[model samples]
Target: MKAVVIGGGIAGLLAARVLTESFDDVVVLERDKLSDEPEYRAGVPQGRHVHGLLVRGGEIMEGLFPGLRDELVRSGAHLMDAGEMRILNPLGWVASGRSGMPLLVVSRPLLETHIRRRVTAKIVDDAHVTGLTFRGSTVDGVLTRDGRIDADLVVDASGRSSKLPAWLAEAGIAVPEPEVVDSRTGYATRLYTAPPEIPVVVAESLSAPDTPRGGIVMRIEGDRVMVTAQGAGGDHPPRDPEGFQQFLDSLRGPIAGMLADAEPVTPVYLFARTASRRIAFEQVTGWPGGLVAIGDAVCVFNPVYGQGMTVAAMAALLFRRHSDFSAKGCRDFQRKVAKTAQGSWVLSSNADQSWAGVEKTPAPLMRAFRWYMKKWQVALVHDQDIFLRFLRVVHLVASPATLMNPVVFRRLAKYSRLDPRPGRRRAARSPR
Candidate 1:
């Protein structure tokens, strides 16, 4: 069997790697030229920004490509326990300790380079896929600039700019409109020489209404730290250095102070396409066979939550588990991929809805859930157990439902009475 995967990004590379197990031959088609070194390319504009390989994502990638974690660490990626990182949420700072969940802090380019090296598949760079080749109702191959490449299965792992919907529409397959919840979030990132005593990840969480700005200082590969200033609801960070520093200073944490004397190594790069979008291809009654879409081709989350890579990894894993090349099999796999993205979509969209300029209002149940989450955030400040659960959920290791367990529910009930004021003040430091 032959599988053709479009886009040689993290999603495409991982999908190609997984397809190698099921298909006799797997080929990846990338529009941009693949570089030997970890250099930024035009295809991935967000490659210059900060990216995190969450604990669950790290585990999945390591399982797919063995020794991946150690290799990343050797290549200058920081491997640290997630809890050791200092996190300044809207409520207060989360206690620093060992949570037993390991995180790999690496840049997009370096991580993609290492994964591309490990993928045992034929990757054809500059093979721009324009459309799909159909054998009657089933998609048999892809139409590229060079020629038609036949495949038993075609996987669309393209990023946010995927043209699968348009291609499908041309083939008479009507797809549903994608669900979107955009908070107008924007990011400004610059690489700085790491100070001697900087934390692995120092982040100030963005809350809605009052605090629309946030920032993070993450230690990545090459002895450098990436400082990203983020804003939502039209309060975007500026591209200029002076304006960026002022925005950082406006954040609730010590991010600005930590980078007071640090020397910048790169110019500030701005990324503003941070909307939560999901297309329900599985819901299409006339969905074609021998084709599947994963990663940003299906759903995209707010970058502030850092869920894109991990969710892409999860979708690839789902693809591997449901590896059947038949018509019904492709439809089933797409459905599973949609299911995988649903949780992250809800989490990201719910948070975005809390912002001021967001048009969508939360339903009654979601409003209640958000209310409970606010209380849960307060509990995270004083309760380590609750914080660990929250960490697991955020890492995609556990379901969000786990946060409503009796233990967490009782804690929320207990902390519900505490003042839920928004600011930098550490509300009720006592562990009562």
Candidate 2:
């Protein structure tokens, strides 16, 4: 059996790696020349932005590539204790502390470079995949600019601008309408020659109504720092140095001040195409077999949330679990891939949709859910237990369902608004 993967970014490399287990031959067709140097691969527009590997994502990657964490550290990746990172949210800030989950902080390119080296598959770089070669619903192989590379299965790990849908339509397959939520968000990132003493992650992401922006400064590999300024809902970050500094200064807290003295080493990189997009492949009646899509090819979240890489890892794992690419098996895997994305979709889109300029309004239930989360955020500021739960859910270590459980519900009840009106204290209600 043979498998061919399109696009050689992190998702495609991981998918190709996973296929090596079940297929006799696995080929990764990449449009960009896969360079040995630790730098951004072409076609990955967001590769220059800030990225994080969630706790669960770290575990899965390590399992797939053993000693990969140590290898990353040896190559200057910061093995961060997620619990110890500082997070400044609109409701309140989470002070640096310790937790059980570890985060591997590295640049997207460096991480991908190492993974690609370990993939052990036949990597054909500079080979652009034009479309799929179909034989009655089952993809027989791919059509590249060079020639046809036949395979039993073809996996689309291509990023957001995937042409797979068009290719599929040509092959007589129709996918469902995509769900999209645009916040008009943008980000500006610049690399600084800061020494290695920087925090593993310095993030300020909180979705209070009308708060349209945030920022972060974290250490990536190579002993340098990446400072990213975020803007949403018509508040776009500037791409020039002076304007970028002003935008950073406008952030909610002191992260901007932290970089006032750091020496910059790269030009400011701007990315404004941050939108939440998802396609329900399982909903497509008679979804084609021998073909599957993962990563940004399936769902692309706002990069500010740092959910893409983690979600891609989970999807690759899901593909491995279902192994076969037969009609029924493909359906089952697509549904599971959609299911794996539900948590991130709910978490990111709900927050992005809350922005003032974002057109889509949350449903009544979603609004109520965010209200509960706002209260929970306030609770998380003071209660370690609540904060830990928040950490787990955000890192994908635990399900969002845990937040609505009785234990958490009771805790949130204590932090409800206590009428700040003069001389009047609303009766304090106990948990039901």
- lDDT per residue, candidate 2, 173-284, as tens digits? 7987889998888889999977545566777763645466788788877778988888888688888999998887766666776676789999999988888999888777
CA shift of 209, model 2, Å:
2.7
Error of 2 at 162 (Å): 0.8
Model 2 residue 311 CA deviation (Å) reads 1.2
TM-score of each: 0.97, 0.94
Error of 2 at 350 (Å): 1.1
Pairs clashing within candidate 1:
none
CA lDDT scores, all candidates in order: 0.86, 0.81
